[model samples]
Target: MHDPIFSKSFTRTQRHRFGAIFLCFIIALAISKPPLHLLSPIGDAVKTQLSINNVGNMLLVDDGGRANIKPIADVNPAEYLQLPSDDAQNKRTSTTISAYSDNGIKMEKKHAIICKNSNYCKIEGDVRIDAKSSTILVATSFANMTKSWCVIEPYPRRGTSRVKKWRVATLEKNDISLPICTQHHTHPSLLFSMGGFTGNYFHDFADILFPLHLTSSQIQKKVQFLATDYKQWWINKFDKILNKLTKHNILDIDRETSQVHCYNELQIGLKFHKELLTLNSSPSMHTFKVLLREAYSLKRERVIRDINVPMPRLMIIDRKRTRVLTNEHQVLRIARKLGFEVVEGVATDLSRFAEAVNSCDVLVGVHGAGLTNMVFLPDNAVVIQVIPFGGVDGFARLDFGNPAKGMNLRYLEYKIRENESSLSRKYSRDHPILRKPELYRNWDQVWSIYLNQQNVSVDLRRFKGILVEALTLLYYK
Candidate 1:
């Protein structure tokens, strides 16, 4: 009764001391050993703090107080993160190797497969590139042969097998023959050849980038590229498209022939169906056109047919040497008379040229590699292929006509008459090179005369009708 204040202060001090001792005990208990029964509660508390929810089956409580938990056999760990209702997510589940630890948590392992067909060879999963030997090493327990190897030329065209070849081998775990990995990449690798007909504008897209887009679009830009027969100019030329295709830097396998680069997943070679066309595929020509527009940051998706302007912009692909438009000025005059703003698609940097091509509503060109720029044209645009006079409609149609429809463009064939061809001026009408040119079925024969040495002077009256038709297609259909 004499010192009530002193008694209250003493009680507060004892409570503070007891709180500190309890906190220390909790910390020491966590450091020493975790009890199986307490693990779920501890994990739940942490999850709650992190605002994590619906992580089903990842945290199993040991209700029986047993130290061991049964492993989830052959079940992919990524599946647990998604809800059962997410079907699309399940289908796009990333390739992963799954294992189980003593605590029943999923661990990762090496899994690989080398799938080969007549068209291409696709190697995926835990892969290593030994540049010293120009070989690709895959790690997997599924290698039944103890050691197995196959040589693959990772290009789309089989005609370029001599350009480059890569040795792919499947090695068992703990194989002493494995090369030391100098670098590790978190993302998957896409390996292909830049050798086969890459310099040509047609082959650049038809053979390499088109097939590459078909193959890599499924990965959602999570892959890096490894190119054999690599060219810096080619890389720079398609930098914009490459940027849309991948976020990682491109590695030149030929130049860096000393490092051993390893990746969790690697895909050797691209998937190619046919040249310049995608048939019954997931990424159809329309989808590819959308990708191209997005990659170039093109402003137009369709040809502008505004009531205020009422005139469409036209692009004439002017070739310098072969298949030159001899009377280009008259063609320009006719196009202008019909209310078309004309511009020439000439040789320039690719990025700049792509923009110029996309801005136009109609693309006019002779059947040549320059017409390949139609890949950059807007949807519903018109492509007028002026076929040189050589009885080569089938060849010209195969090259540009059929693919134009696939890209959602209106294709028009303007077959130049004999009088319009420079070959007509050089030779007589009854000459076999002109009159009976159908006899030359071989491409080598056709290439030397009609393709290699030809120029066109369009019949003004007939060509004007083609332009009129192009205008009708733009506005009406």
Candidate 2:
């Protein structure tokens, strides 16, 4: 015998009770920091939020400069984040640091670093940060012809709650420190450094999706893009904002410094060389950069210090845990026969994906968030993406704004058997694969069981069109 008002009244009362408890819990947390010794992944999220806030303050305020507000975003934009086999928290790694290259510190595939403490480190070094947990990050340097990285560790650590001063000095005339990298350097030209002066502070600001400022000229040269209506909304938003900031002075892309694929905190458009600031392990962003730098036959290459130890090839990277596509192996086999290098790797992280793509001439994948790795590829690299009849077409059209310059789009239609009536009308249908469904209804629909029972063959004609399209683009130079 529940009264209408009484039943709802109980619900309301319980809600209020929980709210009070939650409010009190927040107050308790506000009063004191949690015991960090009880470190767990659950605390990782909280620590990250605080870190983002800390980085944001470093960029916006007159704290006159700090670590180029590391761009650890609020969201993990990875397309696939496979859960661990067990529910237990992973504790194998001690820390996560940003690693950069200088004279004394050396890189091996982006992570698994080696450092030699010497006075020579002053000429070409980067910054190191204590990002909570016993972890230290070795991030890349944000400066001219220099690279940096940060390492994260939880063992045999240095630094305390009050001070994080370590082996490197970030603010001396000898070594270009992280904070000084930002404050001291304002004229980042295409020749001296890379980004921060490439695009308009307003329009180019909108192109990159993060809050970074860029000047006009760099936007014109480094920002290689073909415009479309979809980009119009972003362009409009920036134009309005610029009108206010300029007082009609910084009129358009003509005046503002441009944004490029470089890493900066106040203005995060994109960064191709962020490894110089991030601490990644071998087979990582740092590794790729180290190899590319060596390709130029720099002093780092002539004197093969550490990374030259036969790092993993692109194909083995395909089998790494990051790649978890359903038909990955199958597609690789087919692509190999079709005269394409079949690398089976995933661009799970955006920055890492950018690094991976820079190493390849062609990128192919099923049309999914996983394939946005297109953003990472070199200009004019061909992308052949499979479009499942159910979902892919609409998304591919939007992902590529211009069919001419940045991306070469190719679509492969998925195979789907039509309605049962079409098969029934086939004259003398000897093929068991397409046998009349009415008579075949006796078979269990379980796919694996029936496949073992019946020999099947389908026409390969349709796939040839896609292969030809891919080869044509490959030879395009």
Candidate 3:
């Protein structure tokens, strides 16, 4: 309405005032509104702001909303975090977190969730935890709020009527629940599954019995036994002795089955040999000797009668596989020369074999399965283990010396010299096979080449001293 310059100025002033009001309103709105973290997805919000550089010692937020957490010595800002929401609308299908125990056993939890407010972590879906030996624990739900205790609910078996009567028994009825809950402070019951027969005498027969010797008295009453080979006749015979020793019922389990829950497990090896030797006062040794006597119907008087004789009856184990005595005739000639009644043959009958071994004063054999027959020997008997080349310190001790000590047999090792080994003929002087037996990349190859395929040529001059030692031990004992 006024002059053109004045009108333009008024219009510009009005526009500037409106723009300033709008800018003020936008700034006010932004300042009053809640944070983006409250409105957006939790994982996305956390990923944007959270940085975890020391995941090994701190809680690691996983994509599935589960947190891999360790025990916190002192609470720090970084150690605590808000967990994702549990609203049905915001929930995802699954999540996982990896955890480790103080003993370094690794465990993985799947479909896990953590509550921020309560600090409780829950594991959902099927979870299997393996303890030592063949024992396993299966649970459907597990929760841990603190590092002190973990709560596990056993996975319910289908078609089971009673909650407490879940564990199925073969013959006897027990009202134990599946994944039976025991207090964290109380000692849980132990269950041992018979490791299947490895066929080797030392592995199958003698080694399996070692666990009975290794178990402590505190847990012995709570220990349960399970055997997979219930149908094998030899296993039945072996079970008799095991039952007598353990004084617990041995349950039969299906061959294909796996997974059991126990507080502890027994493994098969000579690692506990020293502990086993302390069981001389245990009834197991006496039961074992009695069972052997009953199995062959041998009179104790007869065994005693044989032991009292002056010359020791020496049975040189004839090998059918590896480490055969190449100079058996000369070796036998030498053995006979040493006043030993040498009994040598591939024993076809086990009873007769047991009887022969039981009657012997000294059992001589190259390190092999035949050496396991030393279990049948009487007390004060001598076991002359021929340490084939590459077997002096390793298999020789594990296979014989340790077990011989447990059986109360005097163990004598006859270490074969380099010249006695047949590998010298097949390999050159500078070859690794001849010089460095340990350098072989595969132990099985070394065993096959140096032990399984090779035979021994006893240097009679050198071996005589070992025989003399055996005689001295037998005579002195």
Candidate 4:
């Protein structure tokens, strides 16, 4: 029954069948989008071809507005990879396809949700706000089996410790259960929470305002806001800045509990970079400073670029709570003696305080939230942050020092002696709380003992030198 010629014939026929199947598979991969490379041997070739077609010759403009037509080689293919969609037959795709300009340059494609698993999601598409349930519903055809819903904190910081208290769910659009939109708008809406250390001025900027600026500015400030964890006072406080940001109203979503608000597009959370410290990238710090000045109607751009300008104005932030400058009057006296026009920053009302801070040439404060007003200071101004005794130089630097440098302001840190700290009254010289604060178990001890209970009676003679340094920097410039 085993004939050699017949056996050879069967083997050839089987080989032909396998070859046809493999060709069909390759052809299918060539037609399909996304993961096509994963299935094909010529993946790299396909990706390179796509890149050449999409991003090779792009016109890029530098800061001086010089447009250079350059071909960017070694571009990452992943960013240019076609976004996947579940419904291939649907005419209106879930995610907006990337459009090219008239010159064939690729534009930023609109996305439904760019998610990093269940933990963090940045949604920007046909988003609906169901205020009653505190749920954000996005209409997308890409809802998949893995995750159909996401829970987000809506704040910039997504760390578990920062966001554990607040939770908002982003759901896939469902027609049957979802409420009909009472209010519909064309502009993209920005959804965020005013929770988690909002009252503190430092957090007010770092956590909320700066991040909001980055997000809104990216879209050219053409957005509406839907705010949860509503605080009217907070709104009133920054009304100028908020009003400048959007032409539309900022709706308190929590207050609008019975209604569903919808937008043509929505960015469900604020964008932040580098721990919300520096505006290292485009929409730079200069842009933000311009926005601030325009918002507050501030005139000053710098601390008098001419060296002939006399007696640069100084602002001493007088803290009423913890970390009070016990010898602030003495400090003021010395500042006046140094040919400075001293004004006290009590910070009773922020909008007014912002104006005053802008008018000044130098800001002096104990290491606290009041120093956050340095954002309002003009360029080439100086900031003197008197660090309280407890070896919190790193914390002080992170919170204010680094940020000040990024804002184009001169910075000086005056580390107080143990005798200058109010802690000396409570703890002995040899006590671990004073001698070795590193031994403290956790943040609780760091906060309750060092940040909360501490006050600085800064040595007048030592502090004067720092203030003099600030004066010299401002006056000479």
Q: Pick the candidate with the highest TM-score.
A: 1
Write down the worst ten-residue block by lDDT for model 1.
38-47
TM-score of 2: 0.28
Cα lDDT of all candidates, in order? 0.66, 0.28, 0.45, 0.60
* TM-score for each of the candidates: 0.74, 0.28, 0.53, 0.71
Model 1: residue 83 alpha-carbon error in angstroms: 40
Q: Clash pairs of candidate 3?
A: 136-260
Give a tens-digit lDDT track for model 1, residues 1-477: 224443345444343344234433432332233111111100111112111122211111111111121211221211212111112222332122222333333335445343433223455566789887888887765333245455566765443423487776667557778877888888877888886555556657777888788878878689898988787767877888888888888989877777889887777777665557765556877888888898888888988675467668998887666678878999999999999998766645666788888889999988766788899899899999998777567656766888898898999989988888999888998898778776664534455567667789999999999999999998888
Query: Which pairs clash in model 4?
Result: none
**Scored by Cα lDDT, where does model 2 land?**
0.28
Clashes of each: 0, 72, 1, 0
Between prediction 1 and prediction 4, the one with superior lDDT is: 1
Model 2, 306-363: lDDT tens per residue? 3333221122123211112334555555556765555546433323444555555555
Model 3 per-residue lDDT tens digits across residues 1-477:
123443344444343344334433433343233221110011111112222222111111111111111111211211222223323212331123233333334445432322111111222333222322222333322233111112211111111111111121111012133433232212223233233222224434443455443443334445444343233544543554455445555555333234333322321111122212333455454445655566565543122333467656788877644677788788778878888887754565566677777778788777665676776788778888777775235545655676676576788888887789887888898987778765652433444465556678888987788888878776664
Model 1 segments beyond 4 Å from truth?
A: 1-119, 142-146, 306-308
Superposed on all Cα atoms, the candidates' RMSDs to the truth, in angstroms, are 23.8, 24.1, 24.3, 17.1
What is the per-residue lDDT of model 4 for residues 1-477, given as tens digits with 9 covering 90 to 100? 224544345444343344334433433332232221010000111112222223212111000110111112222222222212212212221222222333334446433444321222456666677766777766543232112343555765433232322232333355456567888887777777776445445566776788788778866668888787667767876888888788777887787877778776666656554433543456666677788999988888887755665667888876655677888888888988988888757655656777899999888887766677788899999988888776466667766787776788999989988888899999988998878776763434554576667788988888888987887787675
RMSD after Cα superposition, model 4: 17.1
